[model samples]
Target: MGISAAGRAEFDQCRLIDQVLNRLGNAMAINRLIIAEGKDSTAVAAASDSLAEQNESYRRTKRQRAKAGCDGWQRD
Candidate 1:
């Protein structure tokens, strides 16, 4: 999106901040899911995967994971 070097740097910095905030929010949501769903790995994994799909960073960096192609947590 940014053309100039300084502009790109600023954009990256802001993007990093957004990513951090998004992860924090995801963590909170998963924490609540755990509290609600109990110690069920399957459900938690599914919820986390769903959250990852909704996250900009995860969607940008792990497109394959989004499609459940990787060996990581994925739904059937």
Candidate 2:
């Protein structure tokens, strides 16, 4: 029972990881467009700060999952 519950939790986490990967791709494209626009310096700075935090969190999760022996994940 405990083992099945753990497996289910891991499956949920894998789904989350996939979602994060998709959002990260979107974030990259948004960042590029913001850079190209070259407007709203303060807003861009704030957004960049927020993105840095999110990137750190995403990386942390990826690292933790990797340590847990999760597979099929890669980072650029």
Candidate 3:
């Protein structure tokens, strides 16, 4: 038998979540590399601050999407 519509939707949601998590992991790795390769404290701090802002923005967008029922998962 084939999967139901709900099941397929759940599968798609899970896949999207995994893809998001993978991208976060890759971003963290890149941030680490930046810090490790930086020559001075100021350089590292600036990069860290920029990355932190980007992460916060991403989180804010996700929260907005979730609130609007636009994210993959059902809210209610």
**Candidate 1 on 1-76: residue-level lDDT in tens?**
5379965665566566556656757775775677477688887777666665556554454553333333234353
Model 2 ranges with Cα > 4 A deviation: 1-6, 73-76
By TM-score, who's the top model here?
A: 2
What would you estimate as the lDDT of candidate 1? 0.59
Query: TM per model?
Result: 0.41, 0.61, 0.58
Which consecutive 10 residues in model 1 have the weakest lDDT in total?
Answer: 65-74
The sequence of per-residue lDDT tens digits that candidate 2 reaches over residues 1-76 is 2558877787788777768867876785686567567698976887677678767876887777676556765453
Task: Please list the C-alpha lDDT of all candidates, in the order they appear.
Answer: 0.59, 0.72, 0.69
C-alpha lDDT of residue 13 in model 1: 60
Give, for candidate 3, the lowest lDDT window spanning 10 residues. Answer: 67-76
Backbone Cα, N, C clashes tallied per candidate: 0, 0, 0
**Candidate closest to the true structure, highest lDDT:** 2
User: What residue pairs are clashing in model 2?
Assistant: none
Q: Is candidate 1 or candidate 2 better by TM-score?
A: 2
Ranking by lDDT: 2, 3, 1
